[model samples]
Target chain A: MSQNLPLPPIALPGQPLAQSPPYAAGPGTYTTQNPTRTVITASVAGIPRVHADKSVSVTRPSPSHPLLLLPEVASTVLARVTRLNPRQATVEIFAIQGGGDGIHGGGDGGCVCEHTFQGVIRAQDVRATEKDRIKMLESFRVGDVVRAVVISLGDQSNYYLSTASNSLGVVVAHSDAGDPLHPINWRQMACARTGIVEERKVAKPI
Target chain B: MTDRRRINGPLEGTIPPVFLTSSTHKSIIKRSPTTLRKIFLKTGLTPPATGSAFLELPTPSTHSTPTLKLTSSVYGPRPLPSSTTFSSNARLTAELKFSPFSTPGRRRGYIRDGVERDLSAQLSIALGKSVAVGKYPKSAIDVFVSVLDCEGGLGDAGDEAGGGVDVGLMSVLATAISCASAAIADAGIECFDLVAGGVAGLVLEQGGVVEEDRVEKSLEVGQDSDDARRGMRKNGKVTLVLDPSPIDGYIILAAAAVGYMAARDELTLVWTKGSMGWDGDSTDEVERIVDGAITASTGVRLVINEAVKERLLLGLKEMGLIRGKAVSGDGDAAMS
Candidate 1:
């Protein structure tokens, strides 16, 4: 067996960052066509394309492809859990990078999204045994870049997402001085500007 | 990939270019306009004061028998655009339609498909070089082509009963641009040249094909091994046909780069013979058949003119566009 192995990641149809299957990466332009099959055609000059219209900023799907026709998925997120009351939990999330669905498809639900999450905490996860579990109330704070997983379709009217897993935690932090912080141990970092103790993720083990 | 040629034509069975700078193909319809049973004039079916024409050809009734016919209409010359090349010339528009039932199966897709796009692009290129596009800058002269009827039999020999859109073939040049030119003339667009086009192909027997090696690679840091284990391979060779038939492929096209309707040619060289899961290794038999097919298809240029064009124009005008004027004294009899 290979040593130091972790979970397997599926390689997308583009150039691989680390390593990927040779066949998956073709030697040509990867159109929004079938992300699977690569197609090539003549390059006619001066042909007007409909996608050039920017007022709508719509990324129309390829006429042949149906999958990408909808909005794109969110990638990186930043937010914090606040006021995790037993009966009701209110977690306010913020967007460091807005990875909303592409091509005019936005919102988790009908309601416009802002910095907040309000929902019922799972009854089963109400136990305050583990540190991150009990501290789920104080486990998060302002200015913390925490990772999240979509617990449910958050957008009853808006998009729903949560970062309640162990592997899913904060990645970066700033001290009172608003300077970069360095990490030494898990869940903790030393602010370079003020030397204050800050909490962030040690980074995913893999 | 280079394709092997085989002997084709309704007389014999089985199938599937002469290119110097690049390869080009033409489809040879058995009987063209000249050999057609009756002679037809522009004013026979429609008045000269109006636009367009359409025509029909006869076919065998039974056994592997299929029919071929052509129709066309013309429109044009309202204004001009400086952005175009033919500031003093005219613009032409063209379209081709293949009925769903025209072939073995139902055609699919609402948007223009790859093949359709290629055909459209080719038609535009072939006609653009001939028409005074810049003459009516910003304005277009449109021509539409539709395959009204296609039978099982093929003009190219190698074609089987079940393939292509209609499992039938067309006179590449005549069918491609016949309706196109008529539509222009119907629209009254003026230009220096009239583009003509056709299709013809070399036939080849299916031979043997060999597979290549497997490639290996690692997955992403957190990627699953199952994706690789599931087994995936390349899409395999792309099937190509030069002036393909119904079974092999059907391509009707044309061009006019010289006169008001002169000859401007285009070239294509992709060999799609064996991509239909019939690749061959030894090149001898394939070579012989292809040679014969090319030799026989040589007369396509003349065939398109005599067979497909004039007839289609008359028909289009008869059915949709204005009718032809009577031949001199036949006005009363012709109208009846």
Candidate 2:
């Protein structure tokens, strides 16, 4: 029955959707071309929707073009830690999750492009409880995949990221013996093959 | 570095400059002067680019052979480099290049000149307005245009510097704008609307008055700008041309080009050249020039709409949603 739901028409940018006053503009919609006769038009190539509140929007259609993977504030991202210092850890964001509809085609849970974005995790953003005691070496290692939230599109070169919550931190990591790590505690991860414990800011397994 | 081989210039003194001008071969203009030359455009030609398009405009007299040919390619929406400042919106860049053989005479160097740089900057600004740059933040999109042929015989007869000839620049920019928009759409980059570029010029009206005006202008030797005004104010008209060529002989008092988004009825870029009193609070002349440019752009937009719709139909056919028979109509054949 869900498959029987009719799909909305695909809209191109600049296509007129409706007259204003009765229907307000929403995301992917804009009004241009004058001091007279204001017309609501789609600004992105996507599917048009008329919400219950009488606002119109255009959501980017999925399954066509290669997804444009970009990170914005408050969005969860999966990234790999590349370098570290006492002050901050350098990371590269690889994927994004849980934004609204309009991203698709990367085979992953959400959109992933061929390129990656630069990100950083400052020492102060590693945990909420430990304001100053968190060490970069103990929190993350090179090649560890960390789940974090984007705090800000950082100054020029990197997107500021934080792994301060219980659900956010190193989700996948390897021990020195090249063994996969399993969470032992909030601060330690155990390598089952080597029977050795390593320190990491591990995320709670569901 | 090893020495690189280069092309040789034309031999000196084999043909005198006077012989070149005395051939009496006036360019053939077959249609009403205001109509655009026929355009032949096709998309998805460059496999390496995310999207690509090829465009050709044939001389009016020719059957199916193009006198102007250009190609455009679109790339990226990829990550921005770390060295550049981060922007909340996507950065758009455009580049235009003309092959040495594109002109009629002297070969051009491969290095990008000042004119190319200026044109590229204008092109970027024109296209940047039509694209929804905010949708893909922290990224860059680039459009590349290459001109294979040009009108006006620039660089011909050992004029390697390309001095004193600017009539071709407007035509080239107009073609590049329309071509690049199609390439972007082919690349699947989301845009607010497609931008079509057009050109128009102010010329003397056709009549027996040419002889009388020439004699009167010769009698008044010192009033050059005044004479130009007399042509417009008394016996001149604006000819809206979508893709203008230098071969057509016109007084060419002034010319204007515009980048228009037809669906929204917006003018994204307006550029006027020549001294027709446009800058001195002459709102009447300025508005007339702009109006002609917009009318020309509207004609070009009709062609663009059909081309884009054809692309969408091809996509549907490839997806098996439409029958192959319905997709076989070849309306895009070059109508030179």
Candidate 3:
């Protein structure tokens, strides 16, 4: 399918890839408008490919590509809760979901970032319903790994995160006895070994 | 006062032996004014850094000139420090340093000196323009370059006649700019273009009179006769040389270094030093020197393009995307 597209074996930064009329700019490429026409140029050194949808992109080699991922607004992330307070839970963002494919489309699994960024999930954003009745301790613990969506780029210190959806909450947790907990429902998790139940904002099984 | 912590050398010192024939003080190599020294550039040398590169200019056959060696590492697109004010675009910072033993005769200090700081600022400005900073908001990119070995002496002591221009430092700065740009590109940072640095200088031949043989050779090489004549009349037979080296022994009158983007036809940074006249009548002279620097930059850009492509090709080959023959074929293309 990509045979008909005029592709260079490799592309360097600022190398013009194609014109905008036939192909739209994709990842690793940007468009610039001149007096005569718009040109799509490669922004990184990689192999340029033209997608089936008439979009051109320069894809770096797979191994080093994950290092370039960053957490952006409205994107789902996998974060490990590092600290908890009365009003909020601080998390360290470890992986980004859907990679660079919008919010819902999955592109080659998720990209695991090389560096973790600071994020905070406020008490009110723990769930979609009953915002005022939520407790930070019961919803998330310091060691829990939570699935969250970035709501906004908060203050200088942390990225504002939300786990308000049924699918966006604590995906992993441990009981008081330190046994791994399995989700029994949206709000509770039961330990398989200790038979102890803990209250958490649990994510529904996929 | 003398230190008491360690044993010192004997108080009575003996005179060191002196060689009858010293080969180190030989004359410098001679080349055409338009020719530049060959550069060897490679990227991805430091595995720990996000991206790294090494650049070198080999010592001439005479071995009088020291090899110019530089290493640059790039970090980030990572988060900024919390204490800093918020910004909408990515901030780029560059730091250039010389290793203690990189220079001859004297050891450099651990702390950054005024020259290092000045070069760092210039390097930042050169690289900042090529990067698409808007793509990475609220983050910072840091580039660090260390002069592993240096060409030309690192100090201003060498060019006492040049007044303000330090030829050795200018060459080092130019090399550092190119090295940092390669590292940035290797890091996969989004950039509008790759910036290559070049240096050109107006040199005054030792004697006031222009030799008959030299002028005839320059004319035969198709160099502008008017420029040669004008410089002779105005500034004691000044000659413009691309990629001027301090080891050449020529007394430099002025020098210009530029960070040029070949594809975009833009110059990101322009630094000129020395005694170039700033008066209205000397504007053409300044333009001519800058134009010579630009031409030199275009030559360096070709080497950078090949270095980047070589790394990418290796990556593709390792992934089994191309066969061995194709890899060799591409390498041949680059050489040609």
Scored by TM-score, the top model is 3
List the global CA lDDT of all models.
0.35, 0.72, 0.80
Kindly list the per-residue Cα lDDT of model 3 for residues A1-206, writing each as its tens digit.
35576667778999998999978998888898999999999998887777788888777762544337667787789999999998999999998885345311124567777678889999999998999999998898889999999888777768899999988999999888788999999989999997788899998889
Model 1: DockQ score: 0.01
Using lDDT as the measure, name the better of candidate 1 and candidate 2: 2
- How much is the lDDT of residue A80 in candidate 1? 51
Q: Tell me, by DockQ, which candidate is best.
A: 3
* Cα lDDT of model 1 by residue, B1-336, tens digit: 334496444556645434343111122243321233221213123333123444333343433344444455443332223244433333555555555554433343345555555555556555565444543332345555555544333334444321212223334334445445443433333332344333333222222122211212322221553442222113122222333444222221110111113232222211113211123432543443233223222233343344323433333334332334532222222212
TM-score of chain B of 2: 0.77
Candidate 1 lDDT at B29 equals 46
Q: Calculate DockQ per candidate and list them.
A: 0.01, 0.26, 0.53
Model 3: residue B162 alpha-carbon error in angstroms: 7.4
If the candidates were sorted by their TM-score against the true structure, best first, what order would they fall in? Answer: 3, 2, 1
CAPRI class of candidate 1: incorrect
- B1-336: candidate 2 lDDT, tens digit per residue: 434596655557576546353221144564575587777788778877867888886533544233678899988787788788868899999999988877654466799987789889989988999988887778889899999887634322443221112456787888889899888866767678989888877654445447435634543563565654554445544444434566554546567889999887788899997656544655766677788888887787777656655665455444333334442332111100
- Report residue A111 deviation for candidate 1 (angstroms): 62
Query: Residue A59 of model 3: what lDDT?
Result: 72
CA displacement after TM-score superposition, residue A72 of candidate 2 (Å): 0.7
Clash number for candidate 1: 106
